[model samples]
Target: MANGIPLDGGRHAGTPTVGIVGLGLIGGSLARRLVARGIGVVAWNHRPHPYAEAERDGIRCAATLGELVDAGPDLIVLCNPLKAMPGVLVGLRPLLASRPRITLTDVGSVKGMVRQQVEAAGLGDRYVGAHPMAGNEHSGWQAADPALYDGALWALTVTPGTDYARFLAVARFVTEGVGNRIIALDDTTHDQAAALISHMPHVVATALVNTLVADPDRNIAAALAAGSWRDMTRVALTDPERTRAMVEEDSRNVAALLRAMAARLTGVADALDAYDDRALTAFFALGQPFREYKARERAAALAGAERQPEERTLAIPAEGWQETLLASARHGERLVCLAGDHTAVVTAAGMD
Candidate 1:
């Protein structure tokens, strides 16, 4: 088994082709990584600036979205900004109507909203939702690097109505093509988890900077700032407009997470004010599980790349397949690849 996949896990006979909608950070990085791994990629960006560079990197640059479709990619990944999703979907609707075999998916941060827009465009049947857990505080093709996907994990969002073949296509694209791991989830579960882990924290990082700016002694604090501050506030360096758009698209989830986070902060403040040692201890203790989990991750990294603990084969059921994948993901199992239509090879739950 190469790249953690079984000999029978090859989902396609040859290197699969992909169509990219945007050439920004995430899309460009994926294109570069896939191409480096010998997968064929045809990409179209809203602007032609990235085309020259993308072509130089061996990615076929399409002059138009229609031209991208002409490449007959097995999967077309929508990497456009969330705001442009509706319009992009509108354009693709007519073009893709005759190409039902071409599975549609996106790298959108907010799956539920993207799925809604896809459904609104009457293309839901041809769509699956995907969000790769990769990226950085960068934008555009210039910032793109294939290394961005190193050890990346992706979430493939699905519903009961999603075609197993379509889901398999995207799964293979991630696992076999991109050489990444996959966790299956529904849109809501993905969105909520993303909000809790990513969106809310981005906002909190921004708030940290705002707090610094509001302080009259900010220059002094800045001079004394160290690694802890940098680690906590790094995401605040992301393009503000892009961050706002991401937070807004998943507004409900982000807002709810913000409320919960605020309560935690307030409790900490109250505890500190009262000098309650027990409350402070409890607050600190709450995170020990996560800390231990992260420690294990670091240990695993040192254990060598070839070591796959609790790796096991899963026989996918013909019925309740979606739930089967979702349940596995919920418990932190990652699908390495599909061995066959009714078979999945997975790694142990990460939290185990």
Candidate 2:
């Protein structure tokens, strides 16, 4: 399809029947959102606990992985927890082998580890990695909402061996299927950025709350907590077990990031203790670029509907499309959608 330049702008064969392999918060929300958009979704969960509610939400509940595979989905999204990915992949291996037309993807927070697991399962060629920048502290089917994906940005990872047709399928699935934007990247880049922005910050949030809880004046602190405290510690309120699993999956990157964060924090503490003017000045100004970036974002959001983020088209080479997209993403351009099999429309609205 990449070479063929299909006139339909690289859309999947038909309105795809998406197979979802989990019924938890992210999975449930995706299934609900797809169903709401009039796309058929067949879903299977490790337990049938959410089947009834999912069915009412118009998601077809499958009793087994084989049943889900039999639905003839264009792609199967493995939304299961990282801990359960191996088992789920094992169950789908034989079924997917029979249905060679199917592509594979997952919504794991950490990309590098997931690729290893998928490759170990012998599904590497069929795989793509996806991580949605969408979630709140709460999780589970009970917290699932179709609106959770509102204006979400997704990171899609690829390798040299990734089939272009398969990649296009997943791209369309994100841009057109879910009405979201994507940034193409490789596993290492995705993992490192994720650690810096999300994984390390989560640990920092946990430590902030833990420090408060261990304080002698904990009750006073709780009573005095307001917007700043709430914002700082909000993510720590997530299920501890869930946060632990996510951090452990990307332990290497998270640990490295934690060390770097600790160094920065210790520098600030030293500056504060000694009241070193130079050090304190540098410390306070460390985040100026980020603050300016946020200011620009807020100004853009408040700007009139007449204006929008800058947009442009990219010519994707048939031979090295992956490299092209990766470079564009690294420079902070986001793929809005594919204009054709070899051309992509990207926006300049992104963090440097």
Candidate 3:
């Protein structure tokens, strides 16, 4: 039993039975992946079409929030819009009262406000906030893909009342089960990082599109648009309502980042106006090292993903060889010292 939760040994045992609260893109994609893995899914969607679609896809559709709770899910993932999540949480209280064992999580991008709402509703103990950095410009159930979460980074935020063991269970379910990398952080930290990485970039992309479309020379620019412009503005193709909700929900952090970006742009403009070659060169050169570092990080993560963990028992030469054996083990290895030998569990990718 994990934290008073029943540990029933069955086909569904050890694996979490998920009930998703929305059947939009993320929710639908998750349901598809989970169901494909033979995990039973009980999903709820306000829209009839998505519910029907989920049913067609072999997921059990819940008629109401109460019905979803009655389905007795080990975890409930709220995949509604950022603004709509608090109300969903409040509405689930009555149902949650009888089934306190149900763990709750969400896939909302901006976690600070959601964390506040979860705390205010007194569901923080059972709530483990999560944000999967995976999605496309498309929306709805039609865009759902089982591979949506593959190799993605899923951020989990823990509050003061959060159950660490429950959080770990959810994290493992997400990372190991769904093929994602789990990142643990506080809600505030998650929000700030998300703003800089996701929210601000989205705002900038939309603003760039807006600025260009308003210009008289936009037709000419569009005709000549190439890889650079297309790459930067690709996010502008996202669903407007979804983008608007994300920005408005995390407006403070997004605004702060926007202001910083504006300040930097102003610096670049000033250097250009003064024809300062050195300053212009310095400004353009600043991004090189950062981009290179990010590339290296991505390469490392991909390389690590190729490795698979294997348990191996090694006979050590001496009693005090624990440190040496562990030190000699390859990266991503877990070493344990046994009675007369050392057991090294290592992730072997291409190693002989």
Q: What C-alpha lDDT do the candidate models reach, one value each?
A: 0.87, 0.87, 0.74
* lDDT for model 2: 0.87
Task: List the lowest-lDDT window of 10 residues for candidate 1.
Answer: 1-10
Candidate 1 vs candidate 2: which has greater lDDT?
Answer: 2
- Per residue, candidate 1 scores C-alpha lDDT tens digits across 104-193 of 999999899999999999999878899999999989889999999998999999899988778888887888878889999999999999
What RMSD, rounded to one decimal, does every model reach?
3.3, 2.7, 7.5
Runs in model 2 deviating more than 4 A are: 1-16
Q: Over the full model, what C-alpha lDDT does candidate 3 score relative to the true structure? A: 0.74
- For model 2, residues 174-289, the per-residue Cα lDDT tens digits are 98878899998999999999988898889899999999999999999999999999999999999989888988988999999999889988998998899889999998898898
Q: What's the distance in Å from true for residue 270, model 2?
A: 1.4
lDDT of candidate model 1 versus the reference: 0.87
| Cα error, candidate 3, residue 197 (Å) | 1.0
In model 1, the Cα lDDT at residue 87 comes to 91
Error of 2 at 24 (Å): 0.8
